[model samples]
Target: MKPLKRILRILKTISLYALLLIYLSPFFFVLINSFKSRREIISNPFGLPDVWSLDNFVTAFQKMDFVSAFVNSLVITFFSVIGIAVFSSMTAYIFVRTDWRFNKVMFFVMVAAMLIPFQAIMIPLVQIYGGLNLLNSRWILIYMYLGFGSSFAVFLYHGFIKAIPLELEEAAMIDGCSRIQVFFRIVFPLLKPTTLTLIILNVLWIWNDFLLPSLVLISSSNRTLPLTTFYFHGTYTSDYGLLMAALMLTILPVIIFYAFLQKYIIKGVMEGAVKA
Candidate 1:
């Protein structure tokens, strides 16, 4: 029996490692190939570069206009995230705290919106925003992100806020604290883990989003990293080496951001699960 149990455990461990390697293989391939020349990449996709040259990175950087695209992406993501966090939290708090038929209907409507695919509404979205002269604007893009992101953010905050005791807010209110103060000072502070989780998730979504940005941003100057990297793929040919390098550069920040906030994701989930 002991031998059988040990054998099962060893097999399970091996299976887990195999799955991990399979999932990580593409990233490994991309990273190694990013250092190679175009010819070397085509010939030896899995092997190391003959010389660890920065030429691909240099070409990709200039071709993509990395600095400008990076700033554009940063600004759009930062503002969109901030707007989603603040507005969603406040809206969810209202829905949870208030007793009104209209509020309940609105909350349900927002939740229903999540089920509707973006492709269904994108044409109408473009038409409406275009009529309003809102296209090709980064601020408008941020606004669109906030609108799309709010439903899920509100859902998360709604459940988490329900788990919070009302007595805390009531006590604060009794001690001369205004409703707004009670929220910002007491309620919002307790939502730190969930907030961090949402922010990280939103950051990743907004940073990598390609289709939405492409539709909204018509000018080359407003291109994000994903859009910028896409320039390497032309009609007849593609720059594989530079494309790989651009992909690495584009995803590196998101990887670092997730690494920092990953702890909060598990912590938030466990807390919410226990409390709920």
Candidate 2:
């Protein structure tokens, strides 16, 4: 029995490492190829660069309009994430604390909204917002993100909020704190872990989102990193080195962000699951 268990454990470890390598293979390919020349990439895509160079990075940066696109992505992601966190937490708090029928119905409807894919409503969304000339505005895109992202944010917050005790809020109220004061001081601080997780999740989503921004941000100046990369690749036409470099640049910020917040994300998930 011991021998069998030891063999099984070894097999499981090997399987996990193999899967990890498979998942990371594409990124490794892209990183290596980014340093190669266009001809080298085409000839031997998987091999090491004959000479490592920043040539691709320089070209990709210029071609992709890195500064403008990065600023646009940052702005959109910042406002969208802040809005989602604030509104979702408040909405979730209301749903958890209130026993009203309306709150229950609304929460149910929002949860149902999660099952509806963005692709299903995007056409009508474009038409309606375009008719109002709301298309092509970054702020409008942020507002749309707020609406779309809120349901899941609310769902997560609702579960986490339920775990919090009402006695805490009651104590604050007894000490001359109004409802708003109690929420801001007593409850909101306790939501930090979950909020951090939500911020990371929504920031990643908004930063990487291509479709919605493509539809809304018509002007070149207002384009996000992903959109800029699309146009940059089109203009360069089969410059795989530049393409890979641009891709790496686009994903770098989010990777750094995740590295910092990954532990909080895991903690939030565990706490929420245990509470539920």
What are the RMSDs of all candidates, in order?
2.6, 2.6
> Per-residue lDDT for 5-120 in model 1, tens only?
99999999999999999999999888988888889988889888889988888988887789999999999999999899998999999899998999999999999988988899
- Which residue ranges in model 1 land beyond 4 Å of their true spot? 266-276
Worst 10 residues of 2 by lDDT: 267-276
Candidate 2 backbone overlaps, count: 0
- Candidate lDDT scores, in order, read 0.87, 0.89
- Candidate 1 colliding pairs: none
> For candidate 1, what is the lDDT?
0.87
Segments in model 2 whose C-alpha atoms lie over 4 Å from true places = 1-15, 266-276
